[model samples]
Target: MKSIYFTIALLFFVFLFGCGDETPTKETKDEVVEPVLDYYPDNVGSKWIYLNAEGQILTRTIKEGEEFSGITYKMWQAEPPDAETEIWQAESSDSEAEQVFFRKTIAGIRLYTKEIDKSIMKLIKEDFKPLQGWALFNFTVQSSFTEGLLVELPLKPGLDWLVIHIRAAGTLLGGKNIALTLRFTGHSSRKEIITVPAGTFECIRVTYKYEGKLEIAGEIPSSYTETMYVHWLAPDVGIVQIKDAYGTFQLIEYDLTL
Candidate 1:
């Protein structure tokens, strides 16, 4: 009977305290991380110097943030005021200082707006001088233009998007109709290794093409296309080289420390 009582007491003691002295285990969670795309670096004070097509050195710097229609954008200023002014100055008059604004998101980088002393409307009018058709469009100034998507995120070969579309129509003096359409398109072509004055880099090759269609009664009209600019963008370094009708612009030096 004593042995049985001892066995029962031992069983009760273990049942009461065994689980109480055990340590609790923690529940762990798995974290999901998001990927970041750094196609263009816009840190304030970051500067990039390039040798423009005209054999002239051009410098662009990321300055203070500027606001447009309640939204803020990074201001990019190109020094020496006008590099391609000669191409249109005789027709549009003396050019003025210009600043381009940009905004970035997960989707892509956008041309939020731009600033210029001369009116964009005036420049467009001068392009079609002989016809003298009234210019009607969305943007009076460059800033007035709708947000233009400059680069699409997760870029891959053959990726393309319509950056901007402009249409204008008016009646000419001789009871003839004049119509014009202009489109700016962006394409992510391929990866390339570029060597410039700055150095060599592996970059994403992006091209901007301008397509235009002009129609005037009794005049032959067909759409024409030309490359406005080609950019070799280095990862996190921004544009390393640019090729345009004037010539090629290559990166000479860059300072991204800021």
Candidate 2:
């Protein structure tokens, strides 16, 4: 009767509320995001020229059979840094003929010619080795030294900045003890905003530290010093220019195909 009816009604309400409680609650899921990396091409072809502190173009192209003859490349009016001026001209030949030219014009004129088997870029990247106590690029030379030259540049996108660590052993000429330790740090822009003579370029920074002495027989004395330079370039923009503590060097002409 009435009592039974009341009990039934209470059971129905309990069942309804219990069913509602069984419903699942809304949950928020975290989305997985991937990191962005810098893009580096397989081969980077560009010509770099050295200038004097006087703002003069001291580097020139000399024919192989020119007056110097056996000289595959040559430069006149070249000079090295001195107490008054600190600058020199060093050129690289991307030929297997093994030829190189170095000149320094200061108190006196000095010129050197050597048969180089590889290009400056190849030599630098091949001979690069990490220091004993340093935190730099964890890179190891692959089977072919050339392969190691082009590294898989890792970058975190949205930073608008990329940093690179370069370490290598430099050769000393004079009897003076050369530490052969150098730390080079460079950066590039993540966004393509800046423009250069070549094209649109990204921002970049380069810093270096030199220890020990470098001496040349009968020319320069051994001394310890540090140097720094900055480069601005991108795939779209070949090479805008470079700014260093000493001076600024601009890209007169650039051709990536070369």
Candidate 3:
């Protein structure tokens, strides 16, 4: 009887120690680290096709050959606006070297160039003032590129509004359809929170918009008009998507490191 009792006690001790080792401890909610904006990329690249409300392709290659580096972008769009097919291309190397080119069925349409400066951005921020609305905020900037002077604006308003405004200039065609491209830099905000399909994730979003006219001097004496919106979804390291009035393009597959 004594031996049996001693054996039972030893088994119980072993069982208790083994169970303690196998059971996992509950993690405190506070100890869990929520994902930060650092997971988003700084740049985004994509190809897009613009469709009308009926879901018909209205414009071809709206974002083809479009690449966003940091705060700047280059893109082209072609559409059959009238009986003639119109092609437009815009490029911006920095705050400078922004140019716009256009071609229509009409012969001898000239290309225009313009300059973008700080005063333009300030003027835009002050004008077309945006009112906080919905999950987004909207604002416009009066900017000039080689093509002509125009306005750039963001339609969505939300947290980190200014950061989106500054990053946005880089995404504009730099006055691509018009003439010059507006380059925006120098941001003060760092933290961002956004609602994504996966869930609400913290991130830094950059946005900008511009519109203006294009003139080809001594060419087809007509002014071409354009308006654009750009958004860089930066969760942390790089951009997750590049969004415009047409739609959003996912960039995670092209570069996962972001």
Candidate 4:
């Protein structure tokens, strides 16, 4: 009887443990986390094409780096050039409407200014050929195009900062002195999902306030101020849409050759 009881107890224990082991296991799926996007990805050979409301096409490309005063700068060029030959004619490209060199700095992305004087001298040689003999405008800049932060990193909503402040005084025609003051303020507004011709993008909305004061030293001084808040920048994608006084430009295509 003891042997029979022992056998029955052993069998019950085996049945309980064996049944527990035979229970079906639940399957689990791995969760995928998306990558964090950079506000501005400055990879070389990256190109972006935009189409305006007026059917005008704009193209911007990130070209090779150029060395200036021991510092290398990435060149960003825009097509359909908007040349400002009247005052500041310093430029790195003759074919593009706008070409700006940028280098990373502790403060932010700074404008490369080592070649400013060189480009200005070149402009004097070509456009201002007559001013080569003597300095017509004793031009002095408190902070011109030399060092301006393009975009502040780790952008967050409601963040605002002074982008650039430029105060310059120059004499034109060797008599009349002109003074100019320009200030730019940037603000990171919010996060949005927007769709353009290029595609859909999760972007950060940014805005800039531009203020200009011009004194001609004779006529009525003029002051201009405007706030542009329609810039949509996608993470790892760059500028996706822009709306200004002219018109709206939507990203049509982009190639990021990172």
Candidate 5:
């Protein structure tokens, strides 16, 4: 729980200050073939290592390439593989940041959602089938798309997008329930030179704000937590650096086979 909490607080920061940028990808919306976004690399075998503010390091690797329903996805996970790690999806896009599909497994059950849009990534949609004791605390949910966004695309300095997300869930017995709705309004245009273990390069700084509501058992909580993120993305290399209050995930090594 501590690790999950830490990641949530950390990634939220990556969304607020720096995320997307100005480099035009090699592929655009003009072709019949898959347009590979130049700014984001989806090749298999790609790897990234980041050193946090406290000197602790986090690592991710593109284990393989996968295709789903005619769309290709680059599978990413921690350096040392584990069972609980989830696989994220990014469709082919030459201009905008690909929407990510969230997926993972817990205990011994599988769970995931299906919301397809190149610019949308639906989070917190559903939980895997319930076990004997897990369902009492968890709920099931359906669909809620406030709207998607435009990211990893070519932006001059002040372009933004409003991305929506909705999640619903219920207990195994269908008594208790939980739901959440969030809209992330993001804008970016700052550019900076970043140096990591991989190399030094110009990166687009993306930052954004998140606002939404949360409901559990049809009741709103008295207190709510805010979320934000700042990502330093390097064109041609993908996300080279992620920053937050705790530390940083700076790219130390990578292998994106063109």
Candidate 6:
């Protein structure tokens, strides 16, 4: 009877321990943690294409790195030829890129100082940085294009921040100069599931509004405003689409040939 009782006790112990709550293994715990997303990958040969509502397509490509005044910058160029290009000088594409140089300045809203040739010099203002980014303005046109944070990493809803701002004086031509100023306010208000030609993605919708004015030496000050909406930044990917008064844009193709 003692031996039988011993066997029953052993079985009871097994049932208590073996059939009880289970403990999670290290691998299972690790599996529950998601990897952080690196939205932008700023590398050579990275390219993006967008289709506008009017069926117009735009292509942007990252080219070889160029050095300027002891600084190296990745050239982001628009294909099929355009008015301006940006000098994005940053170590990682996963974060916001800095603009050390701007090819054109928006002296007037849509009135840029491009066709005027080297008569103008576009430069980052007073070490003025919006969201830690360079603010560009033209010395000749005395105007600005885009400003503030180009891209905000680890995008999430209710994420709001500055993009760019510029206030500078244009060069004197015929004994007259113009004072130009621009302020860009932007934010990522929310997220949505979006579909494009390339594929479907979970994107963070962002918006920017610009309030700017231009004052010529001998004329009354003129004011202008502009707005932009972008909905193409996908998790693990970068900007996939964009929209502005110019047209509505959607991502058609993308490649990170790096």
State the lDDT of candidate 2 residue by residue for 11-116, as single tens digits: 1100112334454545312535445322321122323344434574312122222223453323322122211011112234334222223221221112332221
Report the lDDT of model 4 for residue 146: 56
Name the better of 2 and 5 by TM-score.
Answer: 5
2 versus 6: better lDDT goes to? 6
User: What would the per-residue lDDT of candidate 1 be over residues 63-146, giving only the tens digit for each residue?
Assistant: 775677888877667665332222112222232534566677667777652322133345444544443454443323223345
The Cα local distance difference test for each model comes to 0.61, 0.29, 0.28, 0.61, 0.46, 0.49
Write model 5 residue lDDT over 1-258, tens digit each, in one string. 233222222222012345357664656435365443345555656666777656776666655444556644444555332111222223242213222332222211111224322212222211223333334344343444312342524433466665434344444345756444444455666778988878998887767555545455755542233435566777788777765443456777777765
Instruction: Compute the lDDT of residue 255 as modeled in candidate 5.
Output: 74
C-alpha lDDT of residue 124 in model 5: 26
List candidate 2 stretches off by more than 4 Å: 1-193, 211-225
> TM-scores for all candidates?
0.71, 0.32, 0.25, 0.66, 0.53, 0.55
Candidate 6, residue 18: lDDT: 40
Assess the local accuracy of residue 207 in candidate 6 as a C-alpha lDDT between 0 and 100.
73
TM-score attained by model 3: 0.25
Q: Which stretches of candidate 3 lie over 4 Å from their true place?
A: 1-192, 197-200, 213-227, 250-254
> Model 6, range 105-153, lDDT digits (tens) per residue?
1220111212221222222233222413423334533324322255454
Worst 10 residues of 1 by lDDT: 6-15
Question: How many angstroms is residue 17 displaced in model 6 relative to the true structure, after the best TM-score fit?
Answer: 42
Query: Which of 2 and 3 is the better model by TM-score?
Result: 2
Per-residue lDDT tens digits for candidate 4, residues 148-246, read 565676555676777666565667674777666666677878789999988999888988666667676677987776663357888878889976544
Model 3 lDDT tens row, 159-232: 22111111122112122211222232211134466444334545445443222222222334232222233334
Preferred candidate (TM-score higher): 1 or 4: 1
Provide the global lDDT of candidate 5 against the true structure. Answer: 0.46
Off by more than 4 A, model 6: 1-34, 81-148, 170-178, 214-224, 229-231
Candidate 3 lDDT: 0.28
